[model samples]
Target: MSSTKVIYALYNDDDVLMDAVKQTRKAHHHIEEVFTPFPVHGLDKAMGLAPTRLAICAFIYGCIGISVATWMMWNIMINDWPQDIGGKPSFSYLQNMPAFVPVMFEMTVFFAAHLMVITFYMRSRLWPFKKAENPDVRTTDDHFLMEVSVSGDEEAMIAFFKNTGAVEVKVIEKH
Candidate 1:
């Protein structure tokens, strides 16, 4: 496969960046990625990205946590050593489920939150001592960066980006 050339467009304002994204899509230019200092609402829909499935993963993790909590409580309270506390019966788990409700709920929340964080970290390839891959440091502050892959022509793409209100346009050839 041949190497690719990418155009980096820098925008100072989020509103201008949003409009540029819409215009680029309408012009049939493939937008590689967009970097922003903060989340831009409705930006994903404009870029035609698929909806995230992280919430579904969280729900699955929550179910696992509740199941573990129930099993542990049943074994500890009813099966291992039956003890009467607060005049509540310990013979049947169902009879004492009300008391365990707090524990169950806490565990569910804990697992969903912690595991989701870990999953995000892993999926993003984030780890201690990893170097950052941001092309422009200004994007982490107040600027936005839009990367577009150039196919046939370079000057026309640069002109197109300038017309889209890019503050700076740089052409990068990737190895």
Candidate 2:
């Protein structure tokens, strides 16, 4: 099941791509992915990358979408079909919480933007119309890719991507 393979390195300079991810993780070499359009500072702690809870699961799915939109507007306009308008009252959240604050801020930004985009596409295995495993198409147009997935010494990972300053290297399979 180790078929999805790639080995690419094309660097210009973000300090030589952060010293080639700290020398290919100190020559242990297991970097699976890295692509750069921006963000290259420290590169997720040199690709250890274990500090994402997805903003605490989008703040607990935005507090369960503001407690199910304030309990479905307190069970439909304060207990089913209640319409007391200007007189207020009818589950008057302290005499009108600014008209339920734009439906609880659009249900907490629609449950924290659709449950933080389905918890970042199920913590980034992605799904549904998933046709991208881009080892390189010049890594989305400018090239800063540094993907590696070697098994053993494939010529010591092609001489550690040309001694950690790879301007271009390629080994591809996982199409």
Question: Can you give the TM-score per candidate against the true fold?
Answer: 0.95, 0.35
lDDT for each of the candidates? 0.94, 0.81
The TM-score of predicted model 2 comes to 0.35
Candidate 2, 92-164: lDDT as tens digits: 5556667887898799889999979877888788999999876567656666888888678677787878888
Model 1 lDDT tens row, 1-175: 6788999999999999999999999988999999999999999998989999999999999999999899999999999999999999999999999999999999999989999999999988999899987889999999999999997788998999999999999999876
Candidate with best TM-score: 1
Candidate 2: pairs in clash: none
Model 1 CA lDDT for position 151 = 70
